[model samples]
Target chain A: MSQVANRHDALDVVGAQWQAVSPRLVTLRRLSLSIVLVPAIVVLVIVLAVTQMWWPGLVAAALLVLWLLACVLIGRQVRAIRYARRDDDLVIRKGVLARRLVVIPYGRMQTVDVSVGPLERRFGLASLQFQTASASTNATLPGLVATEAQSVREELVRLGEKRMRRL
Target chain B: MTGLEPSISDEAASPLQWHRVHPATPLVRMWVALVALALFTLREVDELVSGGYREILALAVSWTAWAVLVGVIAAILTGFYISWRCTGYAVDDERIHFKQGVVWRTERTAPLDKIETIDVRRPLAARLIGLSQLRIEVAGGKDSYLELGFLRLADANVLRDELLTVARLHDRRPGAVTTPEAGIAAEHSSIPVEDALYEPSAVAAQHVLTIPNSRLFAAALLSGEFVTSVGVVIGGVIAVVITGSFATLAGVAALLWGFGGGAVKRFTRNFGFVVTKSDQGLRIGRGLFDHTMQSVPTERIHAIEVRQTVLHRLCQWWQIRATIAGYGEEGDETMLVPVATSDEVLNFLAHFGARWTDEQTIALLVQGMAGDRHQAGDAFQAVPQRARLWDPLGWVRQGHWADDDQVWLRHGRLQRAVSVIELAHCQSASVVQGPLDRKRSLASVEFGLVSGPVSKALDHLDESVAVDLAERSVAEDRRFRQAATAVAGKSGQVL
Candidate 1:
């Protein structure tokens, strides 16, 4: 236990083969952020070019810095997401700063949902959500390779049926 | 998992004999609506005579108007009667089949084993008419709630017994033993009524706890809501006096009404609370005007929570609530007892298969109730000092304890609540950390539970402790299940 405490990944499942999300998720994140922020940057540039005001210049610089910060944060967040299907339970770990780990027995799962946003579709990634009887369970494994997500969903559904439990 | 199948069936394999609810079931509820409709019609007819609508009243010496009103009443009553005629239910060996509706007919089938609760509810009106309502709650959702209402009270009681005998919930083999700490309760036949909590009355089942109506009333007075309501009313009155304003008196009247209504509701809901144990499950009887008898199959409770405010604590009173498998949070039935002595609470816990008979376990449970007193040994996995950042006064008070079968979480500074959840009931587990917890290498853990009053979480433990606790829970759950299966194999029963 002390050794586990000393380890950095102590809160995470240690030996189980962990599956990381598609790195393309980071690109997808950047793309979505760009969709929302690039226009503002463009608008700011236009406003600055028309007026050549010093404040707009400062604002543009600030926007650039903010965009750069978002890029780093999104990359870390996407990379942090990991999930593994252990013998008895499915473990999901995510978050860069705070971190979280969830282990749910397949029998407790009521349903599995797979969804893909336009951005995620462009990046060939899908998100899996597992619903259990408990409302507190927040087991959403996002940014999985599309095919892997489908296979995992099927596997989970099969296992869930084999060990189905009432709420 | 074991009881979900129609196994241990005493139910006769008889052909479906469809039965209709009391013909008056529709009228019980719709009568109120019908009265409202009649009153509105009367106002309209009165206006026709008194106001400018006199021309309409003069058409046929008012007989046409009366005839139209009577026709409308007849049409509505016919609609209700038709609906009553259409509604029917049938019980076969495997499931309950209910079909209702006159135009767009709807049918529902609930597997006998999946029935969560079979409760007898007698609304005041139904009681007055010597009728009762049987509500069969299936755990999945409200859409599955089946109500066979306005049955003769005697008929409802017979049906409730018949359904209880057939429902899979009753087949659950007894012990939901949690961990290594609580030994398997060997004797369940009956315990002596030496404890003061039991009313010294001869009863068929083990007379466990019976709380009187006066105690319920006193507990309500000591309740937080009552205190808050009084405070608000007093504050309002003082404001009116200081401002010399008559307008603010309306707010005071509203406050008074709120206080009186709340008190009446508390009395009606919790009157004559009693818990009894039998071979099958625990029987909870409560309520004043609308009597309810809830048959809680002992194995169905996911967790048990005993709570107290400072005032109630001072009076040595505690309120008991349990998370029955599919009970909605707002349902009055979740309450096991409204007011109980600590001894009565312990007596109740023993009924759930915990080893309250053991001195050490009793100590541990009591310690869990009041929270950390810096006790020696493995009494609790106390929160780390770093938790003080989040809750300075309460950091020392919060704790988590597990004895192979159950997990106990106790926390609070002024008002403390301890929740006892058997390991068998935990469906999932989680370890979470906020940014601050991450900085301190600490995490809080929550074991997933069915929706009810039980809030199972232990915050701010060493990351290692949290992870170990959560992971060990899966192993514990599996071990308990395997042990239960082994016992079942020998005994021809499943836990």
Candidate 2:
């Protein structure tokens, strides 16, 4: 019984160190979605105007519902996103429904990339990605402040090279 | 520099010069381009014919047409020649470098010590021309290495042996006296240096495993892929009969035949597969139409997976696969055994340095049908009761065993899978808490090995247990590396 109790508290120590990204990520997410969805909605409205069909209106409304649901889900997902730097490994945890926790060793990191789009730049946000040996180890952290992304990229790259030399 | 330069006395001592591939290399490499050109010309001929004989006669008589045709041929020949001439490769003391392209010059180099595997592949056309392609898989992921093609079979083998020797030599200590003297002596010797470098006879010949043809054929017949393909064809034919779509029968038949033939051919390619143990590495040779020889060092293997599909479980058979870096690109290269009984798989895995101390793991695998031992208390740490919501059926049997050498995770009830990841190969560990798991205060611990799609997870453990295991796995990974380095230091060979 003591063993079981000990097992339950293992993660309590780890929860203290996780750093959350910026809250403005929710706005960036909505803006990126609207860029594509707004145009799509316009096209659907145009189709409805020309054809004057009930089905197209129904389809447009359905899409609006989906977009609203996506906004809510993306907000939750952004809230759940957290990154932590350990002694030897970098950990990223995200997702709400089907959660994923990716831990990549510094020694295994081959490349660290920072990408920012026009919309993200306007929102002062950028994404950082690290490529490891395994193809499935998709180590990505999005919605970080642009300055934070740059510092993280540089730090990870430097740390990766140092660990690699030790190997 | 003059057109006719004088030969120097130290030419042999100088760094290896960049050597160009054979002249025929261009033709072999650009065969796809040539085929496209031929098809385009044929289509042009069809248009010309429809335009009538007069146009054809006019084209024949026209000097411009003749000049255009000559120019096109000349342009193609010049391009091929330039591409071939510009591409050159050199293997020096420390690295292998390849330089290619005319306008956009590109140079690629791979450190000699980073080469993970050397494979000699021969396609049907290359085999017909008595040539082979040498692929050097590097430590990094795809697109990080170089592939040189269309070399004479003998030359490719010699170059492969040289690279292997350099890789082995790079791992030794600087002051090791026997290696440098032996290396120099072996270079000058008339016989191949590889034969003298290591004692091949140290590994007994009887230990090597060879799969016979009959077994391969039976395995193919029992495979789920083969059965489903046949069923699809039959189902299509039945639909055609009921719908009376006789006109579409030929097209459907042709498609099915093509698909079925490719599957069968792939299945039978490894009919006489043989794996032999050598001083440098394990040498694998197989395939009927395109014979291939590949060598991978034992220490490079990342993880091992033993899969038993629903059908395989009924027959008490398992398929063993290894997750080797730079191997998962091709489906067949990573396979250890296509199909084998529990005993055979255990025997084969023993050679690869996996030992199952507890017979309970094996018993659970072989005789899981009885269902009596599913809940038996053993050394394995079973998942908590909260896991019943996630796994439900197999929650009792789902457990993890972390011995000194390997960490094994078993899951699933009907189609069971047991992944044995060597402790040494574990690069990192992670604890994942899903929404459902967080509610129950449980988490899953995942061990990240070298690049491969297959993953191993010990799911639904107590949150504390998961984190503890993750930390322990990292410690074990460090210990394994230290142990390997110590062994390599003592043996004077990079195991």
Candidate 3:
């Protein structure tokens, strides 16, 4: 009974960690989209200016600012999100507008890669990419401290390895 | 199968002896330096020749001498770098470890149980240099669990033998035992070898089958008729002035030579093909001067495809390829035979335990002709319900599903061809609609199979039907995976 209770408690922790970490991935998604958008918007504004269209230039600038503001807001919202790991699964719950809860069982994890990008490095953060057997289905737990990401990756790898052994 | 009794002491002892690999040979450094010097010389040659011709010639000789001196110095530096960076590999009873890299160092360690194959490749140059490249392919990632690129051939062979011995020992261990006869291996290995073995060969053979040399020459000649006509007009004028009219003959010779050169290039580049059995599974090595060796372990193959073209049918040739689990070269798809005869293709597929039916051949023809304008009479002769909305020119056909296979045709004012593809082992499916396709109410459904280099697309179907088919294919893929896993479990080979 104690063992079962301990397992349940561990599972609860895993679930909480997964929930805490997932929404933070939106920061990466927003950053990636913005990287593409900013250059495109700049090019569009330049093109409009070259065409001697003052109205289109102003409209493009305004749109760029709005996009920047939206990006900032999304980044903040991502920082606020978090996830936790349960004994058997990882739980990811987030979203300011549309709430979502995702549970990924430990057995499903094929690989856990910890990566740090330039921006993430500035923030002293790392992202853990959880890849499953299915190519299309994967989850990223972003915006954790580097140490936290390492610990989480190691823990997940351990659990995943154990599950693999059981199979 | 012989079950040789393992000696008790052999199990207890370590199977490997570590010997440090030699540094990268002097020849490698010389080769690099020679290329660099040649480029530098080419850049400076004209400038030197223009000013101080004699002095520059002396400078050029001195430069060669300087390059040799620098090469020697660089070789020593590189030897030290390589020796410091390179490490020996050894496999103990349990695991294998390889430590080597220059600046961004990496030490890979994989359990002996995880090892798939230990391959040693000896290129002509490497053989002459007395070195071999050892690549240890594991069950995981892009990185060779261990790669020693410049090891003495003897050392590499010993290391390969040791790793293989350890892997075999690990496999035979009571808890870790995995044998191909365990049922799951049959299905896992068979599907991919079967699917990929035909399609790529068929696609490749099309180049040879369609447009024979005479036809190509005729086509070229026809296309260049304007130029020839202009030449003839010039020759008519020149004939009146010239003693023997040699100019016209010269012009004809040049054109023939140009056509002959093009034909020779096409033939030579696509020469020499052989698909043979290797110790692991199958080896497909082809090309005239530059040979490519592709090895596909029967188990790692996810899918196989056999494709035939209209031209290939006349020649009775087909192409075979595989969609494998791991990525190769540019990306995932690896061709077993770019081109081969039907019998050779069948022999290759037979190695993987798959056979094609007579009905499948007819099915292929039907699939190819379904949306083609050239085969319109045949298309209308036995029109399946799936072809109801198929526009040979501007008809919008959408939302038709035919069992496991789907056909789509894009018929416009000029364009025509049928895309008939299978969707059983599909991994992802999508329906794409461009502005033109949307205006015509036509869409293309792409099926991503588990094994192969290319996704099969059924184009010019009705939008709704395409979407429905995409959804159904994805669902079917999921179902197949489930069935495969269940089948895998019953077979009891370790996943």
Candidate 4:
């Protein structure tokens, strides 16, 4: 009876919440996107002011507008990102207008990598990447709180070992 | 440069003794390149000199020039000799070690178990020199596969068998030695051949399938490439007649060359292909110029596909390819059978444990291929009518079926192929929906397969159905695995 309970426990994903990532993810993406924007704007301004090239100025204005629109979209994109941890699988949901949900079972999990970039570390954020035998099916849960990411990685590693299956 | 993690190397026992490769290993390759280069240089000289062939020949053979060329060749040979000296490898029961480089030192250790497949490959040049290369494939992205080359052919084969025997845990007694040297020396020196005691002398080989040279050639002629080339040639001639400009013929010639070359490559890659079965696993042997023998334990094969084009259907022929965990090159499908008749295909599939010898199953396959899948009576679950909006040509035929643990996806119009993968053996399962799919309340389900003979999806099912399928497959996969373990007969082979 206990073994049957344990077997059913592996399918326990009914009421799991899709936990949202750190809101700072938006700021991180916006900052990174702006890093490229600043240099291009600087060059465009100098080229336009010195050469009096209207085309360069026009291009720069268009790029600035597009970058601002992207900044807005990035905020929504970050807000929409969420993940759920089940007994046997991990579920990732992202996108606003067109949503995409990916479910990966722990049994198929080969490696769980926790990465903290300089910018992410500064913001106390980390990312966890999942690898499987199939190279193309890798999924990443980015912008988790650093400590949460570490604990989740450990939990996943435990589940992966428990649910290990030959590929 | 091709090394494993430093931590793994640390855990491994240090290499016992280093063995150097055969001296002729680098010479054959370098010699070929040098001869090609010399011929090219002579051709260029002949073109440049107004005196043509005679003057170029005289200039090429001038005493000083001849001396310089010979000196260069000598220097290269010496470099190769030093390289051969510097490069060395050592293998133990648990790991293989490679130590190479002079200025930039490098050492690599690969655990015996992580090895996917061990192939004894003999390129034409290497074979001529009685040498072979042992290719060890591990599951890393690129530059992951390691090769030990320029060894005597017998030494390579013995080493391969010995390594696989240990790595696969086929034997517990660690049959001859912990080193290739002892094994090779034992085989070469006229000892009592005690090592042969451990090695299975010979099992009555099961001759599964053999594609004749004539059949292979005929298949190539009926292939899509040849058909396309014929069409292109006819169009090129018609266009030439209409425009009356012969330069347009260049386009036709180039396309023809491309098609013919590809078909010829496919043909030769599968030339004299033969598949045989033993108690251990399947022995796949092919290649005319660089014969390769790949032994894939049936248990290691995760996925398989049987395909037929329109012309192939007319000829009642099919091609079979399989996905062995470490046997396939990263992004390319390995051909298990280039071409075989329906009966041969059925026989081959049976070896993989698919009980499909009956007339009913053959009829099921024929219906699944081209007939209305609905007539199969629950043998397949096809796409809904609305899904036809997505695949205008093949939507009606697109379906998925689960026979025992094997989940099969069937799709394709002009070229119909059925890919069968045991879900329990697959890596992962996923469901995705694009904007269009979302609007239609539909989604696609895909199973993650290791690199080879496994690239397909169950496309255009209801969103709910797709998600439910993906989620349920996880449990089904787990259940099958556990039950399979409990039974655990000679896994991979039916007998």
TM-score of each: 0.85, 0.72, 0.48, 0.77
Ranking by TM-score: 1, 4, 2, 3
lDDT of 4 by residue, B408-449 (tens): 778887788888776656666777777777677778888777
**Which one wins by TM-score: 1 or 3?**
1
Runs of candidate 3 with Cα error greater than 4 angstroms are A1-130, A133-167, B1-16, B20-31, B34-87, B93-95, B101-106, B110-120, B129-131, B137-146, B150-272, B286-293, B307-318, B329-333, B354-452, B456-495
Error of 2 at A43 (Å): 13
Q: Put down candidate 2 lDDT per residue, B331-399, tens digits, no spaces.
A: 677876666777776666556533343465566444332232245545566788788898788886677
lDDT of 4: 0.71
In the order shown, the candidates' DockQ scores are 0.43, 0.20, 0.05, 0.29
- What is the CAPRI rating of model 4's predicted complex? acceptable
lDDT of each: 0.75, 0.69, 0.50, 0.71
Off by over 4 Å in 1: A1-8, A51-60, B1-16, B41-77, B142-144, B169-203, B255-260, B354-356, B376-378, B480-495
Q: Candidate 2 deviates by what RMSD?
A: 9.0
TM-score of chain A of each: 0.90, 0.83, 0.64, 0.87
Question: Cα deviation in Å at residue A87, candidate 1?
Answer: 1.1
Global Cα lDDT for candidate 1: 0.75
Position B61, candidate 2: lDDT: 92
